[model samples]
Target: MSKYKLFLLRHGEGAWNKENRFCSWVDQKLSEDGVKEAQDCGRLLKEQGYKFDLVFTSILSRSIQTAWLVLEAMGQEWVPVVKSWRLNERHYGSLIGLNRAEMAQQHGEEKVKLWRRSYDITPPLIDESHPYFLEIYNDRRYTTCDVPIKDLPRAESLKEVLDRLLPYWNSTVVPEIRNGRTVLISAHGNSCRALLKYLEGISDEDIASVTLPTGIPVLLELDENLKPVKPRQLLGDQAKIQAAIKKVEDQGKAKPST
Candidate 1:
């Protein structure tokens, strides 16, 4: 096993996720397939002899549950976990409950694509009238954050997500990594993408094409400075990994079912 390592696992398919909805920060539970996915990810980690020193997860249930399932599979259920808003999924703002295919139909496909993948261009922000606004505002989790409730973001571009994420990486993750811990992060698609953008040094333009699939654990063996020493390893059968990658890439495409 590598000495300094990190595991990034996007949560399994959430309820909204199964519906192909833009489920960011909406706090949905895992779907049946998602639970199985998370359990299998854990079994893979155990079979591969991986042990995490600590875990970091978003406050959202899907991410949180994924982490729990992974640890239980490892029989390391007692490991510490830090749940932070910084690790939350990129807020989709007004697009929260909308299905991707429907959204692509309503707003041209290209515009929807940019909104989903563009580093700098964000979807429209959620107004105070949106239900997402009232939900988060009333949720006790936000109270843990030092910032005022009004200052929390309603939407975020990938660039903005990276900006919020890097501080946590710099302050919390990097230090623990440098200290030689095997870190596991259970987070959302966009948040992990932001972390990958920093670790891989991908450019603003290139990140648009990068897709991280749910329930797959990406293992990174980093050098002292945290650059990948080798290609990322997906801890599963090759065919399964390929299929998961395909599912993620298709999340942006126009589907006839919708």
Candidate 2:
């Protein structure tokens, strides 16, 4: 049991999350409630006696902050944190600031759903002239990485995300897992999906139905072959987790508030 702990956590809610906006790559801070949720997540992991060997998070601040909160609660803030853009929330392209409800209204529910949920369908690209482009595009940290900066991606499908993420997973994460160390990851929704889809071998059609609620820690114990010993388990109240998942699934609806 000591050799197989893998904890995957999505970041707590951001300001845009509360407002129902498409928040990819926007790098917003956690909301007040989000901070509390993250703290609670840390408390839960500490109660479960999770001591991590290493932590990984997206370059985005929200995910990084969640990792910090979780580690602090565990009294293991000293654990090393590795940051990577590969773990970023999927790029929302031209839809970055639009409310999901408005997007569904403009693009129609089905197209919006396909864009949001499909494995390979990329969203409409954001025009470089879109004022937001300069911030992430010109960011020095990403540009200097070994990953080609020109291909940093203005739009990304889940498949594209998985493609980019797998290299890091294979190159970095797999070795640590093979070394029998417990690992923790704090990441975004779509990035977590990429990991889940790969780990569980989920079908593309079925992957569309998957949703990750903010601030829950998902535990997976792998056998020697790296297959899950049992189904993934979510920590915390089951009813609340289900409700949160429902809320996430509802986020793409044309009438999101319904």
Candidate 3:
């Protein structure tokens, strides 16, 4: 049997994504451009003749829509997709749906940076008592009643994401790869990074330097031992990919809106 190939994709842009808001755990729909971008991603993958044995996505619509578009492009539209909350984006706590630049303007760049990048620091929890809570809670496919403003694993630094995500990788993903199934993972920035850390065994400090761009696919080739025989490749226009990643880093510095 041929060695299994793993494909990783981040979701297309969302409304908050366009507004430069922190989406984190908040479930938001894709913007018009985001939808087009997703379709373009599928077309690109289709042109490359990529196919998968199984599909996985975070419960969030951005990830889910991206996966669906990709499968449609691959002509595997009927392939079963498993949605898991464990694969969702890092919850941005009180920062959800808030514009980063405005927040920074009110709060200060240094504090915002700490909230955004610190390994274990969690900002304030989003209030379940807030009017938006029911809409948020009910929209989640995998989250439970246990998921409240405070109770939800509210704030998550990338390190915390790695902690929660790695166990799922070990218990679930590793087995799929070893069993010789071609797996396609549609996930968020940090969750994908967490997977990358496990695959590469990267240092905690170094992972901060890693950035994933939206709508790009990363392909991993592994051996019988499931170790990467080659490094990951970011598909599509190289210049566009780099620019996109830079945009993410820039957005992290934006102030929260008033």
Candidate 4:
């Protein structure tokens, strides 16, 4: 009856997050508040006597930065860390640099919501004509990806994110958990949600309602079969966590004009 521990965290607020933009895979860095949030998360986990044996993060700088801050705060900077493109944020495609609120205003809130939160409805694709296409495709990090640059996603739904992420989960992450290692995964919002959908066996419709607050650690105790023993615990101040959740939930809403 061994119970294994796992921690899932969305990287703290990024510059685009503060501006309510579709960050997708554009590689924005963490905001100042994001830096503090990551540090605080680390300190909080340290206070709870949590130490990670292995850490996984997307190849994106923001995700890597959050993981670094968290480990440093816990004085576990020496933990083994692995980076993978599979854990990167959902590819926002043509919507990459657009403002979320503005998109909502232009397309109607419901349409924007469907694009952002739906399980299978992908946003528009990013082709060679899109502004960021060359920059993204030419990035050195992607050159090392498991698949060719041409094969990477231009647009993806929540289901697509899960599709790309599952292989890594089964091949890399699950085995470590079975070995009794305390694992931490630092990832993007949609990426985290995608993984949760798989781990919790959430239906497509039910998954849309799940919004993760940035920087909060979701701790789960899993049975030998990798099923959660009970409800997952989100570590942090409840009020702040609620507010953060609201912020994420509101990102797709049209902002009232002055």
Q: Whose lDDT is greatest here?
A: 4
Q: What is the C-alpha RMSD of each candidate to the true structure, in Å?
A: 1.5, 1.7, 3.0, 1.2
Candidate 2 backbone collisions, by pair:
none
Model 4 scores a TM of 0.98
Regions of candidate 1 where Cα sits further than 4 Å from its true position: 1-3
C-alpha lDDT values of all predictions: 0.88, 0.89, 0.79, 0.92
What would the TM-score be for candidate 2 when compared with the true structure? 0.95
lDDT measured at residue 97 in model 2 versus the true structure, 0 to 100: 83
Error of 3 at 166 (Å): 2.3
Q: Residue 247 error for model 2, in Å?
A: 0.9
lDDT of 4 by residue, 182-250 (tens): 999999999999998888889999998999988999998888999987887899899988998898899
Q: Candidate 4: list runs displaced more than 4 Å.
A: 256-258
TM-score of each: 0.96, 0.95, 0.88, 0.98
**Per-residue alpha-carbon lDDT of candidate 3 for residues 4-35, written as tens digits (9 for 90 to 100):** 68888888888888888888767788888888
Off by over 4 Å in 3: 129-131, 138-151, 254-258
lDDT of 1 at 124: 89
* lDDT of candidate 1 at residue 125, scale 0 to 100: 91
Task: Compose the digit string of candidate 1's lDDT tens values, residues 123-227.
Answer: 889887886777867898888885777888889999899988888889998998888788999999999999998888889899988888889999988887789
The candidate 2 region of ten consecutive residues with least summed lDDT is 249-258
Model 2 ranges off by over 4 Å: 1-3, 256-258
